[model samples]
Target chain A: MRNLKMTIQYDGGRYKGWQKQKEGESTIQWKIENVLKRMTGEEIQVIGCGRTDAGVHAENYIANFHTNSELSVETMMDYLYEFLPEDIVVKSIKDTTERFHARYNAKGKTYVYRINNGEVRNVFNRKYTYHTSVKLNLDAMREGAKYLVGTHDFQSFTSQKPKTKSTERHIKYININKTGDMIEIEVDGNGFLWNMVRIIVGTLLEVGMGHMKPSDVGRILEEKKRSESGPIAQAKGLCLKEVHY
Target chain B: MRNLKMTIQYDGGRYKGWQKQKEGESTIQWKIENVLKRMTGEEIQVIGCGRTDAGVHAENYIANFHTNSELSVETMMDYLYEFLPEDIVVKSIKDTTERFHARYNAKGKTYVYRINNGEVRNVFNRKYTYHTSVKLNLDAMREGAKYLVGTHDFQSFTSQKPKTKSTERHIKYININKTGDMIEIEVDGNGFLWNMVRIIVGTLLEVGMGHMKPSDVGRILEEKKRSESGPIAQAKGLCLKEVHY
Candidate 1:
């Protein structure tokens, strides 16, 4: 069997996320694996870099699989392009070392959340942006972002149960930039827990709108309680931007 | 009675077109008029500056309507915002001269067509762009575009029947610009016949792909036959960008 790595990009608006589920439930993994199985005549399990929540998009998702089929990478890519749905695309495929696991790779990930700070929605980009009418205090948001940019147990930022394995993760940076009424919050970390990025974005928005003080973010993280964080932001605005190996 | 003009923006991915049809047909005008009728308790008719083909988006579409309702502009805007589909938006509404007619008092319009000259589709923007795998010659397209800038009877560039009133229109400019994998064809004209912009884009694309020479464009215009032009381009890639008053 040869290990094959695939680079994927998808508009996850209509999908139920990346991981495959039981029969009848739609997912990005199921779609790709179904196509791969047909092409190779083998049951394939696509190992995704991570799971994306429903309605969340990804720009550079990586996955790997093992197959005994001796198909050329170009032929496999063309097959995927023809068989997969328009929203899901396999950008490239390559032979990889057997030990290269998509999930267990020692690396980091980057996520981006988009917010439209316009009084009215941007008609063209309405589907991908979280529309917020209230003016955000960027300076305050920046101050709050600094408190969370380091190795911390982001227990309060996730919906995952406390009994789960280690919640400590190294956050490399959280950059907030605004351009023409659109705000992008980029978060780079060793890893993220379930709903962690959404919850973090919600908390930062609360700080920008004066619902919470900048220092409150540090307090919430120390408390390690889900209730201490703000509401989970919408899934449609969050996108997995990059995976560093 | 008062005249009100609305600056509108819409992603026309789902609608039949801009014009209202007989009952049961989905249209942008029908949706807006339905909301206005409920808001005003009076029959309403919205006049658009021009018609856009189905699946053609618009960034700054202009429309005017007459209503006797005494409601404030802000209240009407809020009603429209709440009732209209998420894809369509009224960016602004204003009181205008009673003689203002959306179709008659218009001046000129600018449209843009986006072509993705990439081997793989852009997963995020696939819905808005036309994907072309063939390499386009920018210098050749620019040469062809030069022949189209100026007032002329564009009888050869439209799908409209020849018996139509007049095919003459003033094309102010045709700009072909390439940025990375995207090529934008921006056309500015005083008026356009049915399917004029699309057919023009199709012809220019043919020129860029070496199927036709740059000098062939002038001959095609002189021929004044619809069959003399290239195929009508897809509507999804076209967007009405501006309407100069």
Candidate 2:
């Protein structure tokens, strides 16, 4: 079997996350696999690095699949490009070692969340940004995010109750920046739990809006309770920016 | 009557254009006017700077309306902001001189056309840019654009056949710039005829693609015939960037 690694970019607004669902539900993986079936006449089991919630976008999502087709990479790329939807783009594809699995080899990830903290929204970027009229306190949000960095058991940050799986994660950095009325929060980490990034963002937003103190973040993390965290932020503002192997 | 000058922005992907058409047709004007009627309980007529074609977006389009209601600008702004669709945003509103007309008083306007000149399109900006896999020669397009700048009777660069009306227009500048894979063409002019900017862009694209020589632009203008120009570019890539008073 020939292992093929691919770099993908997609606007996940109309998808049911990355994984394939029952039959009719649309997904990024299902879309590519469907296109590959037509091109190779073989059922291509494409593996994604990770799953992204509905309405989340991605810039450089990594994936891999094993195939027996002897077609050139360029020919397969051209065929896939012609068949895939406009919102989903296959940036590049190449041969890879058999053991270079997409999911297992992923070492780190970076995500970006955009907030339109302006009274007048940006019409051009309406879909990609979450609009909030309330003025956000930047310094406070930055201070709050600092508490979430570094390795710790982040049980308070996720939606699921991890009974057996360890919830410990090492967050490298959390950077909050504002340009014009757009505020972008970039988070890089070794791993993330279900709804973890959104919950952390929500807690920071609470601090920014003066509802919670920056010290509350440390308290919430220590509590190890899901109810201690803030509400989950909207999925539309979140984007999978990078995946490092 | 208070002559209110308002700045508006919209993603014109969904609308037919800026003007109100039939009773059921949706347009920027119709959307705003409908909101005003609900707010003031009066039939309000909103005048736009000019008409934009279908799927054309705007960033800082100027418009005006005469209202009899003694409502504060902020109150009206809030009502409009709350009621208008998310794709349309009323940026600002203020009382202007009674004689200040949106269409007639305009001194000049600036437009921007974006081209995604890359093998793989930017998924986030798919709606805002025109994607062409053909590698464009930037220097050639710039060279062709120079011939169209400055004062000239652009008879061949418009869709409408002007008989007695003056087709003379003073084009201030036409700048072509490339950053990463995005190429932006900015055109500043005193006024434009129907589809003049679109036709001009189409001709420049033809030059960039090596279909026509750069000098052909000069000859096309000299011919003063509609058939001499290239095809009209797509409306989605065009945006009304600014309107000068």
Candidate 3:
């Protein structure tokens, strides 16, 4: 058996997400597995680096699977490219060590949230961004972001009921960039709980709108309560940018 | 009564073009007229500078209409912005002289066609660009464009069967720019016949692919027949960039 790793990019507008569900429901993993099973005549199970919610796009998602087929990586990639739908593309494929696992071996991840601050919505980019007519204070958002860029208990930033041994995670960096009427918030972290990124973005947006102060983020983190944070941002504006290993 | 000129932008993926057609079919002009009629309780007819084919987008389309509504220009613009569909946007509106007709008094127009030369199709921008795997010769295409940038009978470049006495037109400029995997062809002309811009783009594409030489454009123009030119490019790749008065 040989282990193969692949990088993927997908527009998740009409997909149920990156994980397989029921037989009839469509998902990114189910689509790939169905194609591979037909091509190789084997029940192949593919594992992704992480799970993404519905309507969340991905630019550089990673996955790996084991197969007994003798075909070259390039040939397999071509077959996958031809069989996959137009919304999902396999960027690259390569052979990997037999012991490598996609989910377990991941070291970190990065995500980006986009906000369209233009008064008039952009017809072309409406699907990829959250449109807001209200003007946002970038300085206030930057100040709020600074308080959350270290190891801390992020229970307040996630809706997931804490059942794990630790709810603490290290946020490596948070960068806010503005180009024209578009605002992008890029977050890099060691790991994240469910809905953590969306919650953090929502809280920061409140600060930008002057509803919350920069110092309020420190208190929200210390409180370790989900209700104390701002509402979760919409899923359509969140994208999984990269998975680091 | 006042004559109002409006600059509009739209994503034409779901529209039938820029003119009113049958009762059920949707068009840009029809959408605007419907809103105006409801707002003023008067029959509204919008005259566009030119008609765009089905699935052709517009970044800056010009149109004018006469109305007796007493509302200020800004208030009328706000009402249109609030009521128009998300795909169509009114960029700017202002009062213009009664003699300034949208179609009859136009000085010139500009159109842009986009081609994606990347190996992998961009999922995000698929609707806005036409994708091709073949490598294009930009220099050869530029050479061909030079022949078309002057006054000539463009009957061969248009699919329309002209009834007008003269088919001569002045092409001020044709700019071919290549950036990364994107090729943009921008054309400025005194006027254009039906399907003229698309056919011109198709002929230039053939020149880029080495099927037609740069020198063949002069002969094609002399022929003055539609069959002498290449096929018309797809409508989705063409956009009305601006109208110069």
Candidate 4:
């Protein structure tokens, strides 16, 4: 048995995120599995660090899986890049310890959400950015994000989905950076719940746009209710920046 | 007659190019025309500075059209932005002199082509860049480009499809800048022939890769033959940077 560590990147626009689903429904994992099965003539399970929502994207996402086939890690990546859709890219593959797991043993994760704060919509970048067309107070959003740092109950931020039994998580850090026409929110955390980042973003956007007080984020966290937070932002602006282990 | 001056931008990945074409299917002009017709209930003819090829992007393009409608420039641009597909944007519009022409009155046009010179493909930016994993000899390419600046007969770089009466054109500036994993080629020309920029990129790429000598570009120009130049670069990497009139 060989442990293969793959650094994957994908445009999740046409995918049902990263999880495997029905044959007709598209997924990043299903596409990878299909391509690997075709290349090695053996069924291979491609595990991802975490699942992204549909229309979300990734730049450098890490995933690992075990295989008994003779295909070398480098060869597998080369073949996968050639066969996969242009939107998906397998950047690198390497041999790892047999005990390596993409998710269970992860230490920290980082994500970046882009907000287009420009008055005009960027036609080419519409698919990847959240168009606000509003003048945002970045300092207020940054101040609010500081309250989200450190380990705490993120129940107000996470969705009450059936799959998630618990809402507690630790967000190590959240940094908001502003460029000319865009604002980038970078969050580092030990773990995140369903829609946690988007909710945080939505909440922060409200604070930035003066809809909510900057200190209201602390109250939302303490309330431990999903309805207390602002609306969840669109998934398209969210990106799985990195997975760490 | 009200002359409307419009500033436009588009991601040319899906269309057949800027010019109105009947054989190769839909073009950007046709789509804009359809939207304009829908808005004003009248046929409007728009003239652009130059025809950008299929898959070539534009950040700022100029166009002019005559209309008898009472729509304000801001209202027209707003409506166009909403009406046009997510890939195209009408950034600004203004009423201009009746003598204004997008093509004939143009003083200079700037074009940019991006080459992603990296071992790994960027998944998020796949559609906007050309991936060339090989290292390039920047000095050699720059040397070749120096000869391209100034007035010259660009017949060798022009494609021979529908014969144009003249192929000679003046290029005002040629800038080759390489940053990290991308190389940006910027050219300002009085006017470019069909496929001229793409072919020049191909020739410069060959020079950078040591496939063709840097001095060979001068010979190709002197030969005045399309076959003498390198293969035309893919249209996806090229963009109309700006049109100045």
- Which tens-of-lDDT digit does each residue in B155-196 have in candidate 2? 999998767578889999999999999999999999999899
Per-prediction DockQ comes to 0.79, 0.87, 0.65, 0.79
Give the TM-score of each candidate.
0.98, 0.98, 0.95, 0.96
Indicate the docking level reached by candidate 1. Answer: medium
Q: Pick the DockQ winner.
A: 2
i-RMS of candidate 4: 1.2
Of all native A–B interface contacts, model 4 reproduces a fraction of 0.85
Please provide, for model 3 over B33-146, each residue's C-alpha lDDT reduced to its tens digit, 9 standing for 90 to 100: 999999888898998998999899999899998999888978888899999998898988899998889899889999999999987777778888988878999999899989
Cα lDDT for residue B228, candidate 1: 86
Q: What TM-score results for chain B when candidate 2 is compared with the true chain B? A: 0.97
Question: What are the lDDT figures for the candidates, one per model?
Answer: 0.93, 0.93, 0.90, 0.87
Q: Model 1 reproduces what portion of true contacts? A: 0.71
Candidates 2 and 3 compared: the better one by TM-score is: 2
i-RMS for every candidate: 1.0, 0.8, 1.1, 1.2
**Candidate 3's residue-wise lDDT over A126-191, tens digit each?**
888988879999999999999999999999998788766578999999999999999999999988
lDDT of model 3 at position B240: 91
TM-score of chain B of each: 0.98, 0.97, 0.96, 0.96
Which 10 successive residues of model 4 chain A have the least lDDT summed? A160-169
